[model samples]
Target: MSREEVKLPDLPVPTALDADEEAEKNLTTAPEVPVTPYTPSAVTPWSQDSGVATLTADTAPGTTVPVDDLPIAVGVPEGADPAAIDGDWKVDLAAPAASQDAGVSGMIMRVTPPADADPAAQVSIAVDTAGFADLYGTQAAARFGMVLLPNCVMDSPDSGDCAADGGTTTMSG
Candidate 1:
């Protein structure tokens, strides 16, 4: 008759529930958020840009000269009417294809967009910075533009591997 019996009820060890007090006592069962009502997509006319084009001839290091008309600032499709998106506005300066490791001799230089910047969403080109200071000497110059949108034209044009758009400045010697 050796029994160590009859002992019960002293429970208090289940911890782990204070996610902000179960989301302030809502007792967790959340997640179903979606409010929807803004619908606005499908306005692609033209867009392909690059920046920085100063030194409009004569900073005098080697005689600068790197602004053959390049003004690009676009975005007008909300209510749409930046003057019916102005003129034909074609711009084709392809790339620096003049060989000799791109020292200048490329083609496709169809430009126009500076009649006082017309309606002003912007699109200006006239890049032919002749001899651009004996091949990039005065520093700073990069202009790669592609903006020809008659009406809803979308062509990726396969650049696949990529490395055509250019940029290289700060070379004074």
Candidate 2:
């Protein structure tokens, strides 16, 4: 004997009103507060030194502080494109032999030891094309970027190639 084919029930289409129904129907009315007109004070203003003693009378007690807005550039070899960075870049602050530089755009990340770590064991973090690219994407390498060799990890999972001495780095972006 031939068996009859089973038919599935059709799902109902949502009505236009159902789709446009307002989920929140709160109708709160705030209590009205009578606002008084603001009037200027008729009394005279008090003197600055009336309550407090004058700290300086003969000379102004202030010193000018110089701020250097000059950009601090990292030492990258001349004519070397920053986009070409695609390897493990190690930065040894003591020796300076592993010190290499490259250009960047969006952001730069580095890895460093924890605060409790020994001061003498501090190592410099490095950023490569893949690291930089992963950070700001490949487009960032095209533009001019600065290097920021952080003394510690940025606290991000996908930051640089790897953590310096297996430490984590945090990412701002």
Highest-TM-score candidate: 1
Q: What are the per-residue Cα lDDT tens digits for candidate 1 across 1-173?
A: 33567677899999997456435554566788998864434222122333333322122222222222332322223444444444334343334432223333323333444354345453323443333423432221344334332211122222322224423232581
Candidate 2 lDDT tens digits, 46-150: 111101111111212221111111111122233433223322232222111122222222333332223343444322222234323333333444554545544
What are the TM-scores, per candidate, against the unseen true structure? 0.20, 0.16
TM-score of 1: 0.20
Number of clashes found in candidate 1: 1
Residue 109 C-alpha lDDT in model 2: 31
Score each candidate by Cα lDDT.
0.35, 0.31
